[model samples]
Target chain A: MTAAPRPAPVAIDDPADPRLAPYTAMRERDLVGRAGRFIVEGEVTLRVMLSARARFGLESVLLAPERLAGLAEALARLPGDVPVYTATKPVMSAITGFPIHRGVLGVGLRGTEAPGAPLPGLPPALAPALVVGLVGLTNHDNVGGLFRNAAAFGADAVLLDAGTCDPLYRKAIRVSAGAALIVPFRQLADADAILAFAARHALEPLALSPGGGETLAALLPPARTLLLLGSEGPGLPPDLMERLRTVRIPMAPEFDSLNVATAGAIALHHLSRSA
Target chain B: MTAAPRPAPVAIDDPADPRLAPYTAMRERDLVGRAGRFIVEGEVTLRVMLSARARFGLESVLLAPERLAGLAEALARLPGDVPVYTATKPVMSAITGFPIHRGVLGVGLRGTEAPGAPLPGLPPALAPALVVGLVGLTNHDNVGGLFRNAAAFGADAVLLDAGTCDPLYRKAIRVSAGAALIVPFRQLADADAILAFAARHALEPLALSPGGGETLAALLPPARTLLLLGSEGPGLPPDLMERLRTVRIPMAPEFDSLNVATAGAIALHHLSRSA
Candidate 1:
């Protein structure tokens, strides 16, 4: 089927326009279970989202009026029901919490699905995909970077533990450079269920530690893998460590460990390529 | 020689005490070119410094009185002339521009040139070592993470090319968890010089790219190798790519590239183990 006709352009001159409420309110909203959405800003992430076919039901596209002419062709290609909101730079900044660096922002509905149904219909061959589990990683920037890396390195999905921060948090979304939306992910239950599920799927679970058995390269698992990582200071809890194979990225004689997200990326990259 | 006696302890009730000047003006003070002067905060990093046998020409050690009482035994063990400044939490925070989460801060002289000197004394069999090159990475956190990873993955040294950020920035030092101090590194003139130096040392230089010729596993050079990394947004520059053997970490379809520091960790982990 041909794509839907482009959305009608809606000009927004006043920053206080009532139609822009949801977009503006996004800045201070709790966002955990909110039906409204977060924004994906800048050209690169915007392009990534469009190409991924993840933005099929866009709520509205906001842009600075002066830059609207530059994005006209791309704007013309979006689905018809998606309204395009044009605002001055100052108004857009006021609506969002920060300066509008990318000149484009896509407001989308928050997505929800049962944690168990991360991927709907993939067969067993794709069954035991590489999933990176994040536990207690509170830094939004780090979480965002991890998602970006996960998307870049091709982790099948990201599973966040109970204490982990919301992936849709504005800072997290911006930090992921919008990759959080594109990457297949779910906020799973606690670490126990995550480990049990991996075990059930025959996915070898490996916990990254500074002082683990074999170096990551030496213990590249034969089956699908789950690279489990924890926050910076207090690494994987001893209880969790008891459930999985502990592996480390070997370092020089003096250094201790890499940053949590960096370590995660390395482990994900290794698992992606080896599998 | 017997270790110098630990410096006398001093107590200051006021945040504005003149003796607390260096600690207070740390961020505002330009640190480059200063000999034997650097800041270390937090217990873990402080422990790392103490254990590394880093020269203890410490200018001052600032601690909250509560922390001081707990660490008094350890403080008593320090060598001569190392001054300890005790203050209340507010005074400590006021002096350092933030709460001292580690509850301890040490201003020590930056070590002189002994560590950075060429390893000319080693036998021919051990002449060459693995060196990791970082190019155009300006983020302090990234730089800090790179150093920490470099040290963990047994990289002998980190070579910084022009356009890179200072590895000694305060944020970098803290983020590195203080491994930045322990890892032997030097800033180089240009990428060309680094390439030439690697060639001279019989070190194989592998430039990382998202779509390089071979997977990192297949293309890692012999034991003596150098892994080159670029900034997060752009991979290696075209000229540097032309000068070195290129390799890629095979990633999943639709993913872009891993973060520069994460990529470095993976490469270092892979190459070091195989070597």
Candidate 2:
């Protein structure tokens, strides 16, 4: 395939320049809304963002000169209109309000057509699939980790309920190894909506709980299935569990539970491969 | 079991009381050193420390009055010689130099008979077991999460090379859901010793790597197996991987890698159960 023409690097000298708004004091700004745009940091995550052009719109990029050479190939794939800014280490740090150790950053727009919609639909190859639905998962690390596990196990998609943290949160993106950029995911209004979606698609919705109906090892994943998880403390809500089948990962009685992310990994591995 | 006589709670009003040394500026002190002792925070971890009476000696405990009732059972198990300090929330926070929302804390001594030795050996029920050996794993969260996973899957023990962080770090203990206290683990001076010990126990040593010799899903775990892991970035040192059988969890090519702890969880699940 012919490479898309690369955009020349635009020099950014001023930290307060309007063009650098998206990258300004990113950690604090991340707490506020980002509209439809999100900051993608690190060379690895930037490449993932650029590659999944259909899922994420490459709005712009700010990079230290040295990082350009390493990302040269991925840069070539960027659309000509996408602006690429280069700055020295100090200047880049000033722009981002933190040391840009990896020296690469990009602004990406979610693929959802409208505000609050789910991500781009899954590909046909993932038609008959296993998906993970997350409910009330506010921890960014866990959100990123579950995406990484979902990607590793070849799960079709991740469905996030309203209470889940943004997958594009800077720390989450880095922790997911950029799987949050590559994986198909959509944020639903609530846990019930995710269950409804699962039903409409002929997928069996399985909620994970410590007191689940069947041990994970003993159950067979249906042709199309959605494994649901909740935050560790409260776990899946009783009402939600009552509406769907529940599965538990057998554990030693002495321990209370595994980290939510670890539990997701084990269950994903079991359903995606073993079952 | 008959309850042992309970120690009367000593009231400590001053955070600077010398008796509160172990709880003083705990986060900072944790970095400097705690001699052979470590801070065990949260009620659950305190319970584990008390239950592990033989492995961990309770030096003293500082608790908020409200937490006393919840911990009464575990507290009863503590020896009469162990000091139990009761304090108000403000006094407790002052002593720890942080908010003590869990309102329970204990200081536990490492059980190794000598410096730099392995942890207490595994119990007989864990014979013919699956274990995890870690090298260069310095992240406290990952270390703790691995212990949690090991506990969930009933892995016999965790062995850490000297480069690995102490699993008893307060954050690690909390993150492990107290598994760090219950799970048997020991620090070896280097990778060579860990490999040697696995051999002495007739365990088939398998190092995990992205470029492993075999896919984890394709392998059958031996009667006794030791899964070796390295830090996420550098992964296992090449020489170490060269010396042992290596395995990789199959994943989508587009994604980078899973969190080291998540990777460990998947591998441990595969070895201990699926295989």
Candidate 2 per-residue C-alpha lDDT over A1-275 given as tens digits, one digit per residue, 9 for 90 to 100: 97666657988888888998888888888999688889888877888877842367789998988888888887887888889998888998988788778788889886456764543544333366788899999999899989888887788789999899999898898888788887788888999899888867777888888889998877877767888999988999998888788998777777758889889987887787643
Candidate 2 has which clashing residue pairs, if any?
none
**Deviation of model 1 at A198, angstroms:** 3.4
In candidate 1 chain A, where is summed lDDT lowest over 10 consecutive residues? A118-127
Chain A: TM-score in each model? 0.88, 0.91
| Counted clashes in each candidate structure | 20, 0
Looking at model 2 chain A, which ten-residue stretch has the lowest summed lDDT?
A117-126
lDDT of each: 0.72, 0.83
Off by over 4 Å in 2: A1-14, A25-28, A52-54, A64-73, A86-104, A114-127, B1-15, B25-28, B52-54, B64-73, B86-104, B114-119, B123-127
Tens digit per residue, CA lDDT, model 1, B133-184? 8888888878988888877876777878877887766678777777777676
Two-chain DockQ for model 1: 0.62
